[model samples]
Target: MTKSTIKVAALSAAIVTALAGCNSDSGSNNVTERPTIAECKTYEPTQPVIVKGDNQDLNFQTITIGATGDMHGRIFAYDYALDDVDVNAGFTKISTLLHEERAQNDNFLMIDLGDTFQGNSAELFNPLPIHPVVETMNHMEYDVWVPGNHEFDFDRDFLFRNLEGFNGAVISSNIIWHENAVDCKNTGQETPFLRGYQIFDYNGAKVAVIGLTPSHVSSWNASNPDNFRNLDFKEEFESLENTVDEVIAQYQPDVVIGALHHGRSETHGVVGVNEIASKMADKFDVIFMGHEHARFIEQIDLGAAFENGMDDITVSGDKANQVEDKAKSGTYNWRNRDSKVKVIEPGNWGWALAKAEIDLFKDQDGNWKIYDTTLSNRTVADVEEDAALQSEMQHVHDKSVEVANEVIGKIVGNFTNTSNGGADEAVLEEQVLNSEGQRLYTTIHSAKVSDMPLTDLINQIQIMYVEEKGSEAIKEQIKVDVSAAALFSDASNLFNGDTYRRKDSANLYMYDNQLVAVNITGENLKAYMEWSYRYFNTYQYGDITVSFDPEVASFNYDIFDGDIEYVVDLSQEAGNRIEITSISGSDFDKTATYVLAINDYRFGSTMLVEGWVTEEDKIWDSSNETIYAIRDMLTEYVGLNDLYRTEFENVNWYIKQYGPSDAKGNVADEDKGEILQLREDGGEGQDLWERLQNKEICVMRSGPGARDSINVSVNVDNNNTWFVNPNASNPYEGCTYSNQPK
Candidate 1:
């Protein structure tokens, strides 16, 4: 074994010996004494030994810790998937900052909080003896390493190789090798997959860093078992506290840092970082977290109850509004709390570096204790990229960029013209203006308002995949009558003149989610559609834009295609919005069963959660077959069919009642010249009118919670609702009130 591998093995062995209660074998001359659970249970914190003539007055030392997480393969200052230059983030920028921080601080340590080995072009180099990202981390001399859930996205062997290659200690307190699992590490016996925690010596003081990965990886990757094959994750709270207790009992470090790969909020059974940090506040001093891809530095008051209940304690970066009774009452000062723990998360893709400068002082007894800590998230906006590091990884960067830009296929038609007389082939893409009048050229804006070729392409590919590669039962019995896919990104688009590239495919389907076909009744299907249509706000008089419910994510708004016709009437409330007219050229049946194609995330999180479907209802899955992920499947489809023929007729759904309709069920000529004139006068409702002409919805781009009070209330005059803008003192500020209209 190499030096790094040997170091990891030795360290891991010692950790396993201490935690697993492993006894000395018959071959051993002496009985090796290891800390038992009973002994650990009775253990107390260790006391320090004082040296004579050690002056307590001048015994202060400041330790600086710099951390980054969710790097996601951003080794260079570029997005390999988009083939776009990223000026904001990259490992080189982080390296420059780290180097600068190291020069300024007497005691400095670098840490990476994990999710390092996957995403972008990182996977392309996985087959290498040492992955470039891991090699880069090794070069940077990372002191403590935590493995996030995404670390298991690839094969177990690949993960192990990279971990073994990493020079730093791989510490994950919550993971253990399964009893029946084959030893992928090639060790003679089964042991903990990684060391629980690593203790670092800063000058004379010791700092213990405990690493925690999310426990919900198995649930997230239920469709793909091979990702985390031999590993089992323990409950975060129980495992973390136990490890902390053990660390304190064995070696009472001056400082304790939680390097967590979990978020602050409790989501989908994954324990929140705050829950552990709060309940175990006496031991922990500082915590660094990741996996939510957010950035923030907040001092959490320990053992304090949240004013709005447990679920209300959220610290989502950029959008956090944490309210606590203690905070409001002025009893929850960060430094004055019973135990103050500062939590910091550096935003994903190397956007910022989370720093904690902790000052410690030696007491009369020579016991080192924390005096104070300063936390900040330093942005990489103005930092110069490390040219040396970038130079070293240039070959990999070039290859990734080349792969991203490699043309797979071509699109011949714009797919916009359903009627033949229009310039379909000549039109590449029409530049449209948003409500703000900013010129935008994209497929997403139009796709969201009505059925478009982009989503239709996704739906068609899924249906074709099911028909071609599904199981015998699925193919013979249930036909894929309908398929649904979300317009995953606002950047996803297809231009008539442009060729399909790898980036194009990736942009179209941004996730690694597997395709799943579930059986559902027409009632459940309609219910699902209604739930999706709830993303839009209800229409009201003098309403300018089709706003979104801030609570709803756009990705959850699935659009259906294939042998189906439906209308989303924004005038109606959510539950009554979806009106499915027909399926398979027949009247919609509420009780009749039909197979629906959807991504695994939606199936697991929504379909299963809502009790609308079960595992038994699943007829086919891309994971069970040899089909690629939806993104790769898109590329494969493009490769097979070099030229896309946009005989695009799958405009199966549309919105209604948002604008006037004629006797022929089309947008009627406005007899109400006041409304037309009001729209023509510009501002507020002008863009909505322009969009109405194209059968599109004008989306409101206000930040979340900004539109909460924007609604329609029933008017007493004619049972018609008027617009209510929360920000406007006069509700109908710019527009004419309906009492004098028409």
Candidate 2:
């Protein structure tokens, strides 16, 4: 057979085990006859009578086992309680796999690696007091069920009441009862309910299966401290090893298996299944590990032992892979050979089912031993639907589908493309021109502008900032640059793309406006007249530069010269850290005011920009809202063709010519200047005020009797100010200088 054909054949053989048995039709019809405790204990297998002629004979013994994981029952299909068909289909598939295996082998055991309660709407939304998941698992009739960490999501009372109704054995070796507490009758703490080991006798062969759960229950469950208050979780490996030793010494079982909740790696390691397989290889003949959701079938050797006059090998393996290493030489060893013990994990949410077949043979000493084992997946797609289970889960499935189909919102435009072109001409440039004739290259994209409201944006920014940098870091950065004047200073011009290229979206540059300040002295004002000549010398931006005379005062600033006349000495100015000493009277306040021009990002008061709250004379609240409104207005006005336009008017060209010069006539290149003019509705300085005004602005007051002067304060007992005015007609206005004290 071809490799593909061989693989298909092996998979088919793994799911179904055919064992030859006598025609005991007498007990076949006794479905309702529950065997007594003594009768069930004494049940023994009868050897099949072989019809042999000459030297020909036919007899075979096989047992099939099925495993699965993560059945968070009682939970709705999803968070919204939609998509119940998928959930029902999953349960149906598991049920079908179970019955199929049982049909192939009379003695078949089905185990579930847990996580069967408390998730989604079913658990959260249901009006009924009892957990529906408990009823479903009980109906499935799992032979053995292990408790997962999430099983305790519900309080202990609910767990006890529901588990009491389950027909299967609920096992956990790590949970220890408290010395002073009275046993809860319905819980695993009750007698006979809590079993360290269960011995199953199949055809005169005894197989002992030990159960263990992770000791770190508190780490996963918040309610664990309350629910399992009377119980102590012991070390997993230590508890399992001790239990296995005791069981082996007492029962001398032919095979040992462990149902373990702990994975092999550190508490939080990747590929936890492999780690568990490696560490516990020497402990058990076969181990079924959970906690980590991974699928594999491999064998690891534990050691060699003499059983039934034959050298029996104890191998560690999973149901996904069939070969494992043996630790006969003190260290775990593995060979590329067929495996005996198979571990399997059917991933979360009943997405898949795992099946294994173990062949048992008797040795010369009449002791049974595992001869061989194989594992395979019976895809959920292949299993026929169980009508009863489907009927029960139909309502949930329909609800889930309905919720998934509804649309949340619409995308009116495409996302932004940030790729840089190879050639200069290949670059796309767009500019914005202020009414004063100042021009700035402004590229408006969807990432730069979106449909989300400005208020929502501000809320997100504030929440994100607080989450990333502690409240203290935010406070410090604000205190350092309140006016945000230094925010555009030379020190802030440092840019490192490599260090900033983080995968997180929060770390990316999100400002929508840029500020540019001009400081000209009377001595250099004449030289600065030639700024237009120097500006046009640089590479052409989106539009070609034009020359004009400097006849208009678009902005207000001081004209300083080497002569001290009219040159206000700002050396003693407390908050004049931006180096511009003689600011407009309207720009200064005895209350320590600031003028802030920012983009939608800054106006939203995103923690990404420091000092938004602490260091501004005045902020424009129209930041994010203005952008959204502009987009909407532009969409209507331009119909999405080109929502914005810019022209290099006369004043912009005149100012660009002189550029920025030093004392030695060393001219600074405008093109190389880190500061770039961002073109939005508000000009650089005015934009900050607009953003602040658009936001929920607040005015803060500090000092002993000054408390009532300000409208609102961000934090009490501090000089920090907040512009909590969301309805300001113009968020940014002239700063009012105050000399009066309360």
Candidate 3:
């Protein structure tokens, strides 16, 4: 028998022993019980068995492939930032389910769809030759690995080191060497940085797996060109098509799989995995997707339906359906596209594993052809973590925990209280740190919506860093006039007392974003503010609650400080939300230029994409300094000044039309008293304001807030016909805005 056959036979025999362990209820023995992998009691296949051919021959084998994506470095069932045990998901938990699946299948192969080694506690191990994420994968014996966009978040050398440390075959067909790189020895522009695909021969049956990373890595990481200094990530579709054709021609594989590190839904105008799988249904048998952090199994129809179907469908002629038309139809199912392809994503953070079982049979022509395929996500919610793996990774976990608990500085006050004109103090939800009465207070509502000390602290730090430690050229040219920052986490907070740990700082500023100072035109600055305000949905009549647009990411919304004053009009649509009153306390100028402080991510994803600026816009970047991470800078700043004080007053920007407006939904100066009274009154007014703050009510009006008697609409029991007068003593006369139990 061949080596593949021998391995299959051994794995097949192990199934009996695995089943015995799973079915064991023996209670006679009193010996010490070792840590064991959990049986898959909740492992019910979600998708039905898909069969393509009929063959009842002995020359058939079932190959099981397991996958995980966008892990974001959750190797252990613990949150290092939170400094608590997170029993939800981890590689240790996933290992249990993986072991169970491997024992059941005759042949097994494991793959991680990339985005490992970057989030939370994962970066703590970056200095090591083998990162904890790669170490865990190596321990699991992963067969193939792909690179995600975040893999390029660090320096080139760190990424290369981890990739080299992995035992698995690293692959990304789209990544190639840049021609002008000094380090380009044998790898010129045409040479791929890693293997494009890996062919696995199982008993002479070849299975080809092609890997593709996000094509927008260059744009995403443009802030630090050195991160991907010698690499070029080609477009996904062309690269995938070329690689698939080459793999088929060279290997003549019986089965083809796509290990793609792209989301299912299109983002930033990039083609999503769903669309790619649909367009290439005839070429690939299975495709695993990542980066969206979702778990699902979906299939698409082939040939006629695949080409002619609407909404993410590809067509050939004049009668073809348009994607825009389908979008306008308002019934397009983006989750499950109408095409001939099998796509699966196993979520993120080691919560679930993507599994694809392919049953191959020797056809009449003496060639191996796939007969049956099944795709599903195996969740590890009910499974116990692999004790052996957890033990091995114990040192890393302990170090992370130690780092998390280490006191970085002393913070005596809160960082989320409002100062300009709203709530005097943020409603604090006290969290007990330990039995010693140490505490941290988390804000009940998102500080991103309004001016708060937390975000102001970030903006202040950026301006301070650039002015004091900026390049000599930047100091000579101009000082930072404005700075913008986003509250990455809603739970961001400082200690209520005098003790602040490293975790507290991490909770406030999570990512490893570097500080950047850029020269921006007044026109572009206003436009940038408008784009950031797109996070809020336009206010409507009877909208008792303020809401955000689902399409816009919350992190993209930034708060401006340092010599700028603006008002965000929620009543106005995007591109028209920001009403800048002044710059440096003077009249706003649209033609003038000013220095703006921001993170590198904003410089790439926003400023560059919007055509507001280019690489030449940058005056200074922290990547050239001693510390690059914004989180680390904040920590250092906090350490230098032990007392946590609001360095800058939260008066730069505030929101308009986020509360109860006048009868016509207008913000009349005369109605200010009534509005505040209504919000303060313990009756309908207070109810309205609280509901709006809590996001429990949405009141929609018929027209602009200028009418004296505007019609307000509120949804009541699936009905949107409820109308009322906003100026009336009981503006909610006909509208029951509250959906809560009375």
Candidate lDDT values, in order: 0.64, 0.37, 0.65
Worst window of 10 by summed lDDT in candidate 1:
37-46
Measured with C-alpha atoms, the lDDT of residue 342 in candidate 3 is 70
Candidate 3 Cα lDDT to native: 0.65
lDDT of 3 at 253: 80
Model 2 agreement with the true structure over 548-631: per-residue lDDT tens digits: 112211111112211111111112222221222233322323244322222322222222122223223222232123222111
Candidate 3 TM-score, true structure as reference: 0.76
Kindly report which residue pairs in candidate 1 clash with one another.
none
586-691 per-residue lDDT for model 3 (tens digits)? 8999999889999988898779888888888888888777666777777677667764554544466667644323222234455343224355557765665564
Best by lDDT: 3
Model 1's alpha-carbon lDDT is 0.64
Q: How far is candidate 2 from the true structure (C-alpha RMSD, Å)?
A: 25.8
Ranking of all predicted structures according to TM-score, beginning with the best and ending with the worst: 3, 1, 2
Each prediction's TM-score against the native? 0.74, 0.44, 0.76
* TM-score for predicted model 1 compared with the true structure: 0.74
